[model samples]
Target: MVVSNIISGYQKTQKLSVAPFRQMQSAFDRDCLFTEKIYIIGYSFGDKHINEMIRVAITHNPNVKIIIIDPSYKDEKAKKAILEIWSDEIITPQVENMKFGEFLKQQIK
Candidate 1:
């Protein structure tokens, strides 16, 4: 039920100082390890820790599928960055040039 895991930009330092924040990050890492598919929506891929977690998950489970839904992914630079992170030949993520709402509508249909 608690969706907001990381602290806001103003509280960035608190992320490292707070125990609960560390636990939340650990939980995210654990989930990545077990999840077969990951749907990343509108994430800037700015968090090195989260990016590393996903990389580790893919390394541990090569069969894991990644779906990235963000309009900016249509840009070559943005798309290239994401591909570079999950850069295994077998771990090709399904990149979509659409927003989350649009993706959901298509899925519903």
Candidate 2:
């Protein structure tokens, strides 16, 4: 059985009504608020809900650290674009310009 609450495509009117989605969102918010470090991987910052949660978390916890890992961020333009998404907040997230596999290998070493 596959249980997913993913909003596919550009359906802007779709709302997350499933219990699992709610639970997951709640957990994500809790983790964002309490966790000292957040490592983001391959997220495009397209989801408004997720972005808003992250913004709120940053605002609530100014000392929390953010680490973003994405190969595209190797380019200065791409890194700037990602940073611009959160321009409203005063943050300088540590960026890892590498693929997930490479990051995992480094972590295992």
Candidate 3:
């Protein structure tokens, strides 16, 4: 929530600080670790800390599903890092370079 809300807060203040970054980052890490699977909607996964959490899930929880729906996740480096951390054993979950609505429509069809 902090990550998402930060955008709006920045719009008002036009500035941001690192004071709350650690707390929210820790929360995201905890959620990623505790949850069985993670569904990343619009997140770019550019944050190093969140990326580490994803890697942790991939390495430690093969059963955990990772469903990512983001059109902007086209960076080859990011994709490679994800696949490398995930390895080849676990079946990759749903991922698509499209809007959630469009993706869901296709899924329904």
lDDT for 55 (candidate 2): 79
The better-scoring model by TM-score among 1 and 3 is 1
Q: Assess every candidate by TM-score.
A: 0.79, 0.79, 0.58
Q: Where does the lowest 10-residue lDDT sum fall in candidate 1? A: 8-17
lDDT of 2 at 76: 65
The numbered model that scores best in lDDT is 1
Tens-digit lDDT track of model 1 for 1-109: 4646656676564565567777787788888999989888888777666678888988997888999898877567456555757666457778898989999999999
Listed per candidate, the RMSD to the true structure in angstroms reads 3.2, 2.7, 5.8
List residue ranges in candidate 3 displaced over 4 A.
Answer: 1-18, 72-78, 81-84, 88-91, 103-109
| Model 3: how far residue 54 lies from native, Å | 0.5
State, as a TM-score between 0 and 1, how close model 2 is to the true structure: 0.79
Ranking by lDDT: 1, 2, 3
Q: What are the clashing pairs of model 2?
A: none
